[model samples]
Target: MSRIGKKPVALPSGVEAKIDGQTVEVKGPKGVRSFTATDDVTLAVEDGALSVTPRGKSKRARQQWGMTRTMVANLVTGVTDGFKKELEINGVGYRAAMEGKNIKLSLGLSHDVVFQVPDGVTVTAPKNTQLIVEGIDEQQVGQVAANIRAWRKPEPYKGKGIKYVDEYIFRKEGKKK
Candidate 1:
């Protein structure tokens, strides 16, 4: 038996959940989100909570059982509190600014890098060296942050680049004179 799949995902206050076949939809104060599970798993809503179970004892069924449960839980959390990712720019002459719906980044490059914000997600630049990404879907928010960080990843030597607020950069020793 799957330990994670055994526990039901409780519906918090002001949050509603519904299950139609293998699809689970959740609505909350923030927004609404839905997820479709594989055929190896079964979905149901009961006792003010959502639950997932494997249709068979096979390996794939067991895998789907846990994954489906977690997906449903994520849907509930996304609809309720949503997700957020923060990035910090650390480099000389490196900064970020918002232009309409796009973000302009200056990572010590000759030309400024323009990143267009995607739909269902919001990007904000509170400071020239800080960025905040928010969205109802956790995956989208994370992916957007990753894409932004890819433009200027932190260097081990000087630790000068873009990175997550809570991330740590491993430094390397300089060559001997």
Candidate 2:
């Protein structure tokens, strides 16, 4: 049994959830978002709340059920509030700077890489090494942050690269000589 899946997602004030067949739509003060539940997943709304359940107990079904439910809940919450992700750049000469809607990053590479930030997604780097990504959609915020981090993952040796805030970098000992 999934712990988060069991709880009914509470709809915030002025937030509304509507189910039309497999599609579930959420509207809130922030914005609106919708998702369609798959065959293994089912969605239900009651008393200003939403709940998702699986049709079977199989592993695949359970996964689909949990993922869909979580996505739906996230949509509701995101529409009501918002989401944010923080990233930190490590390593000498590795820093980030923003230019208009595009962010320029220097990860000790031959040249700087420029990444375009999508609309509704905001990025800020108070310090050259610290980054903050904010948006209404959690997935987009996370994906963009991950893509930026992928430019230079923290290496095990020097642990220098881009990484999320509070993320631990596991160091690996050098091979025996």
Candidate 3:
């Protein structure tokens, strides 16, 4: 009894969804993306709508079926709306630059650190202190942003380092003498 998988996904105008065997290809005005449904999850396009049907009510079948549907829906929406993540450098002299398909960061260390960017992901740094990660895949976009933030996490005491714009660092007050 999966509530979400039971609902059909309406195909927006200018968006085309088709099934090629086990893979579902969705093409929209923004871009194109595809996904292969897992076992027990059937994908079909009917009357300009995409639907996912579970083979049975077993735990594995229900879980995979619903997960596949959610992932497929995300893939379709990501290609159309795209995804973005923003990070800020808090420490003084900490900055970043785009260098040869990699992001070069100087986080108060003696040497610069360079992180290679995977294919299909775009890293934009309008300002050295600001980082913008954009991609069609939501998972990739978020993972890249998290990895970048992990390089020099913000310290609770000083709150200096790389962190998301909305992230909050819980600070513990110093003990009184």
Candidate 4:
């Protein structure tokens, strides 16, 4: 009954997928990633594609069907195209720079904030106000970007802070005495 679950994930050339019990492991040129689904769903790789099916008519099985299928698809995509997140810094004297394996941020604070880059994820500052985070794992890439943005979230008044490149800040009118 899940539309997404009904579709099989196609395996491209140079990409391989293997199924072992409830776990699905995908390997591609970029890297390898695996996902373990719950017993409510079954996994299989056939016809150069991976598929997921519910084990029963129960609600839990139905719920897991779609999620499990998406997880497997993510594993395939991660090992192939990978993921990226961009951040923009907006504020006077606020900027970012790459310091070896970490990022140094100046958010108009008393002292600069040093964020350590985790393994499997790369953070690069193309410009003083721009940061690019990339990794084969979607979750890690997104989390790293979020953590960087957390250092100085955008404020509504002046819209001065760090935010996603595509993010929009709702500005409020200043006080009119």
Query: Largest TM-score belongs to which candidate?
Result: 4
Tens-digit lDDT track for model 2 on 71-128? Answer: 8889987887789899999898999999988999998889999999988789998999
Q: Model 2: how far is 1 from its true place, Å?
A: 5.8
Clashing pairs in 2: none
Which of the predicted structures, 2 or 4, would earn the higher TM-score when compared with the native? 4
Q: Which RMSD values do the candidates have, in order?
A: 0.8, 2.6, 1.7, 0.7
TM-score, every prediction: 0.97, 0.85, 0.90, 0.98
Per-model CA lDDT versus the true structure: 0.93, 0.88, 0.87, 0.93
Model 1 steric clash pairs:
none
Task: Give the Å error, residue 172, model 3.
Answer: 2.0
Q: Give the TM-score of candidate 2.
A: 0.85
Q: Candidate 3 residues 6-84, lDDT tens each?
A: 8888787888887887798888866788888877888888887788998877889999877888887887787678889
**Which parts of model 2 are misplaced by more than 4 Å?**
1-4, 55-63, 172-177
Which residue runs does candidate 3 get wrong by more than 4 Å?
A: 175-177
lDDT of 3 at 56: 74
